[model samples]
Target chain A: MDDGISHNNNNNQILCPIKPIRCIVKLGGAAITCKNEIEKMNEESLEKVSSQLRQAMISGLSSVKICGMDWSKRPGNSEASPTVDDFSDQSLLDSDRFIVVHGAGSFGHFQASKSGVHKGGLNQPLVKAGFVATRISVTTLNLEIVRALAREGIPSIGMSPFSCGWLTCERNVASADVSMVAKAIDSGFVPVLHGDAVLDEAQDCTILSGDVIIRHLAAQLKPEYVVFLITVAAHDTTGGMVTKIWEAAMIAKLGIDVYIVKAATDDSLRALRGELKGNNVPEEWLGTVIRLLR
Target chain B: MDDGISHNNNNNQILCPIKPIRCIVKLGGAAITCKNEIEKMNEESLEKVSSQLRQAMISGLSSVKICGMDWSKRPGNSEASPTVDDFSDQSLLDSDRFIVVHGAGSFGHFQASKSGVHKGGLNQPLVKAGFVATRISVTTLNLEIVRALAREGIPSIGMSPFSCGWLTCERNVASADVSMVAKAIDSGFVPVLHGDAVLDEAQDCTILSGDVIIRHLAAQLKPEYVVFLITVAAHDTTGGMVTKIWEAAMIAKLGIDVYIVKAATDDSLRALRGELKGNNVPEEWLGTVIRLLR
Candidate 1:
């Protein structure tokens, strides 16, 4: 699989550098939830996505090693090089691993919009109500997704940001302790996260979109690829496809390959395997690839 | 409720201090789990505890304000004092709030003990398996507790430390980001945490008992009171009543009051109310009171 390392600057000195992440899959809320209905989950779509994920894990897609990493060969950087001992192979045990971040389609948007939760005013009663309602809604969806994955024999743990100090200040991510995510990945558990109502330094509270979460995780984990499972159509209170595309571009800027693929299709699997690598649009590939223009 | 404030040295400059935490309730594993059987929940006991918690919340047990604060009058501190603006009333809204930490009795002890997970050797497949198994077992129980709380109309969210960077080095808590717990309390949601496996720097992994979690939180949150819900008898892999009492004494040394009350009794409600204060053991109190010597 070409060592599964992208041609980008991986110069960030991450704490305790582990193996580069293999892939990050985003299950769009529309693909997994009945957006028109209140808090309704499209169980069929969720089941299909879970099954595909199970197949991908069992195929050993995440245990690949990124070789040929030179401390002094990276582009546009001048730093003291480490000794040869630092470059020793730290191979991980054979454990299926990946991360899943889902969105709040119908589950949380209703309560969030009604309470104006994204605006953040703790002094207001409605905002507090909205925040609680939105959390319950999104966390419930996260639980269902974990259950679906568990039914397929996947060890998935729900890791919501709201209660884990993934806070935003002035609507931008101020601080997020990804060490837990790193440890979970290192321990071979599929940590499932989602869009959640988080504490904001400027605004009292705000809805942290799943797209932002994906960008943050990619930057931190430096995954080789990110796959977005797109649904046909749906109502969304956060944003539309344009926002997703913009988020994807931002992630691509970090040198991670981003694929926006149709959900419940063979291309999803192809994207997971890093098999859709072509500059030209191929008829067989059912997704658009976003990457740095090399 | 004596404004629900303790005599503890509140000199620690917490990041953006909100109102003080009212109380921290420890729901013993034996009280809510069938210790003799694997993965069995004592639904009847859970329902009773949940009902009592609901009663406490609806009675406005968490909203008492700690008045009469003069930063200049505090003892044993020679730090610079902040202006009056720093001590401005940051009173939280009248949303019932407290933190709940539960133990893993039969649910997780089997998996953890069988795998010798506390010893921490990530290279060994058994330790890794034990990590995943223990996490799954405890998290499943946390979900049940949240469900029980929700059924009784409590806005409870499961916040497990294993998936949130709550790490221990050499069996002592190295770091715990309590900002999320603070934010949840400020926003009026009851945060439910549990004992589980966490990453260790010295050891590869180890069990983080609920008692240690209580002490860590007590130091950070500085709640007015702490209540330990005790069961008559049970098997515990983490530690038994002795460890719990030791943990309670440790909390008491911090100048905050601690109570060890029998579960399924009205004394639990009394502990939550901070109404059971006496040096002499009252026969009607039905619990042991641990406190610092004046």
Candidate 2:
């Protein structure tokens, strides 16, 4: 409700369409929740981060926010072999231009690791259960994040990756049918996506990371900025923590600036809001930058 | 999301259930959006409704809330005629027990009326398109309602009725397979359902209402009270405006006390949370109480 919260860094010559700044914000589970707890959400952190995004949106910037579910699931919450995208498409139809995707975190990790679904190339019962559990875990978090955004007055819709995601035989995201996502953004609704259990042509079903989703979207949408928010601080290792980091690098070569907020804070948000000195701010210059190797 | 916001209304003699007090809060389209406009959401009204529900939840009550989208859609939002409920199950895995179902207000009305899908007698091309369009409209508002609840930190998962619903030849809800809803509620998650274009054995497709969803859930779950929040405030036909009345009479036969909040106000929400004295309270006793004629 602040009267003066419009775009502040748009004039930096970041190249793209003539409309609002089409950006993507990624949230890591660690940043938004207590990683050790089951379905635990950090309201203060989430509110601060959401308020920052809200500020950006109000300021004339258009972006999609994705959350990483590194550790947000509780066990015994899944049932049978279930696909993840059953409820995704319709959500895309009416979301604010902000697209979101989150990681499976605790929800799928045990099952995925137990079933060896993450590594792909398996059809064991445990792995099958892992796929089901993974979908449940990620989706559970997706609802949580969606509800959080709803409270924030941001019309952010939840899209299960399996609903629009497809993977290669090698366990990488092959397709995410993001046309609805594109349309949603164009129409001004935030489409929320998350790292989820996706059906892989080769591996049966595999993990699709929020990072991978961002890269694919950057390539497809060709947005001005692909921003990543790692709520949980990693051990100085990027790319490896999330899926398809190398692919994101390839996207950066496509002339898109990939910015990462390793730790989402008021200061970093302010910095992001502050215009870049030029179109090409060095990758290191940006906080938690995820550089696709040139 | 908010650590302290669990259902506080259950401790009182909220009636029936040995578990949490299961209730349904129905939001008429008029209560949350401008019935006249296309895809426009009344944030103020929605906020009021959401806050009240949040209050009830915080007060120790377990319930499923449904939003009515009987008139919440415009045009040009459909793509390639997609089926709703693409991601339905995954969401239910980790949702709060508060179940939600909204009317297909604006989104489905036109196509539904044009194709006569509501009548559910035949299958024609327009009816098919109407099915798609209607699904999109209802889904659109489903996302809106989900977003609203998300903002409130209530992990309300959206469910497409068609995903788990079926209609009989009479065009009424034959089955809604709300097992997932029951599970979510048992697990303390809110399952958000909405009126949608569900498949019919005879009519091909039919319009499902949030009211019907409540009635259906009442039978299977046997919640202590079937509470309906008529946000539209349709005339002064009953308790003030939208709380209790006729539709509830249809549900009272189940031996459940029916409470209606004609409008989303503090008093009504308080009243809904208040204990119902006997098996029957006078109509004027509460905002609007419906007693089935013996």
RMSD to truth, every model? 13.4, 18.8
User: After aligning candidate 1 to the native by TM-score, how far in Å is the CA of A122 from where it should be?
Assistant: 3.2
Alpha carbon deviation, residue B5, candidate 1 (Å): 18
Which candidate number maximizes DockQ? 1
Question: On residues B201-236, what C-alpha lDDT tens digit does candidate 2 reach at each position?
Answer: 565556766777777777656666766666544442
What's the true lDDT of residue B113 in model 1?
A: 78
* Local accuracy by lDDT, each model: 0.72, 0.52
- Model 2 lDDT per residue over A3-75, tens place: 1111122111122332443566677666776656544667677777776766665454335333111111113
Task: Mark the regions of model 2 whose C-alpha exceeds 4 Å error after superposition.
Answer: A1-294, B1-21, B60-97, B121-123, B231-246, B277-286, B292-294
| Estimated TM-score for each candidate | 0.78, 0.45
Model 1 Cα shift for residue A178 (angstroms): 1.9
TM-score (chain B) for candidate 2 is 0.72
lDDT of 1 at A64: 36
